[model samples]
Target: MVTTLLTPVGDAPWSTEEFESRLRAVPEERYHDRHAFNIRMHSGALSQAELRCWIANRFHYQRHLPVKDALITAKLPTPALRRMWLRRIQDHDGLEEGEGGIERWLRLGEAAGLDRETLLRGDTVLPGVRLAVDGYVNFCRLRPPLEAVAASLTELSAPDLIRTRVAAFERHYPWIDPDGLAYFRSRVPQSRRDGAEALRLVLSWAYTRKDQERAVAALRFACDVLWSLLDAVAHEHCPEGS
Candidate 1:
């Protein structure tokens, strides 16, 4: 009979060292070094067409932010926690149309020469992109509250990425209009604040073997989701150097 290998569950409540170690490893192993969008952005190698494609495709990701936030908010049991999380949705969606993160991203898209309709259609999304984002929302919905919070640890690596991205935009996309880069610039501080809060919530709440295991699993899944999204973007957009 064929049998699957039984990997260590790591489910028991973890010490602070165990928790942090798991957290650190997720990004190191799974973050988006392989994503073409990031590779191009970091290397200052993206053409205007590549930049435009990145903006156009990223619209789907921005549009889904509030939907996932709503799913998370629905699961929170306390009014205080719900209220705290509500701000997260508002930050992405804003009080009106043509505002907030999505709008800012749209501005970036337009600057990259993509139209609003094409950006919004979602038809152009690469297959792996949907899988990664769907996995993220699913992980958030299925995991315990502490574990779900832990999954947001993608933010831990995000601030550094945001800085690099901002510099890359300035250096490489000089003709893309500085105002259009506001979305990337805006996210750096937001990522830091959100990452810190999510880390605090996870570290403070996950105090048992089962909880630690679940937290680590959630973080691993989150990293996979992020890495997969970039992989799809790279595969579909860059295509091994065309």
Candidate 2:
């Protein structure tokens, strides 16, 4: 019989490469890209209603991204880190009204036939989605800055997922306006840049073995939060009997 042994945390201080590998490994095992909902989405198996529900539910997550970033920003110890991290806020919130990723997502909601006002209202957000998204925000708020920075390393896997999603949208969901795809298109490059910076910060800050373990644990928590969000969406929109 074969049994798998868990890799014990705090075994030793990881080299930069090893630490990065451990961080990247979380996505391999737990990224939402592997979720059943995303697989169906990529395969074009989701119905239009299902797609709309996903957009509406995911908007809650998108809207909270800046909030989480802000929490992380508050924990940064240096002005340089704060300055560097502030761009993430600007990327989501923009300099003015009618701009930024949030606006683009509202357009996506409109393209999906949802009312922009209604999506913003968020009355339809699932309780589990709320818990998952809120859990992410609170984790950033409460954890050590290094762990919070590590949590954002989930961006490392995001560029690939965004690329796959963009292709899936273009190939299968042509009913959505091309303009509505701007959110995913914009994220491809942004996530790459952000992920690189975040990985650098995590590698620099988590120099001790226990610190490295905490960073890895933070990243795993983020992956689980994202997976839970999708699980909630799947349970609601793709129930087994249906």
| lDDT of all predictions | 0.76, 0.89
Pairs of residues at least 3 apart in sequence or in different chains that clash in candidate 1: 11-209, 12-209, 13-208, 13-209
Off by over 4 Å in 1: 1-12, 33-37, 237-242
Deviation from native of the Cα of residue 124 in model 2, angstroms: 1.2
Give the per-residue lDDT digits (tens) of candidate 1, residues 1-242.
99988647654456787778888788877777546668877888876666665666567767877877788788888998899888889889988877799889888877766677767787567777777777777777776678777877888888888898888888877877789889888899998898888887778887677777777788878777766666665666542111
Instruction: Give TM per candidate.
Output: 0.87, 0.93
Instruction: Give the number of the best model, judged by TM-score.
Output: 2
lDDT of 2 by residue, 1-242 (tens): 99998667647688888878888999889899999999999999988878887898899999999999999998888899899999999999998998899999999888767788888888678899999999999998899899988988889999999999999999999988888989999999999999999998889888788999999999999999999988888888532111
Kindly give the stretch of ten consecutive residues in candidate 1 with the minimal lDDT sum: 233-242
- Listing every candidate in turn, what is its Cα RMSD in Å to the true structure after a full C-alpha superposition? 6.0, 6.5
TM-score, cand. 2: 0.93
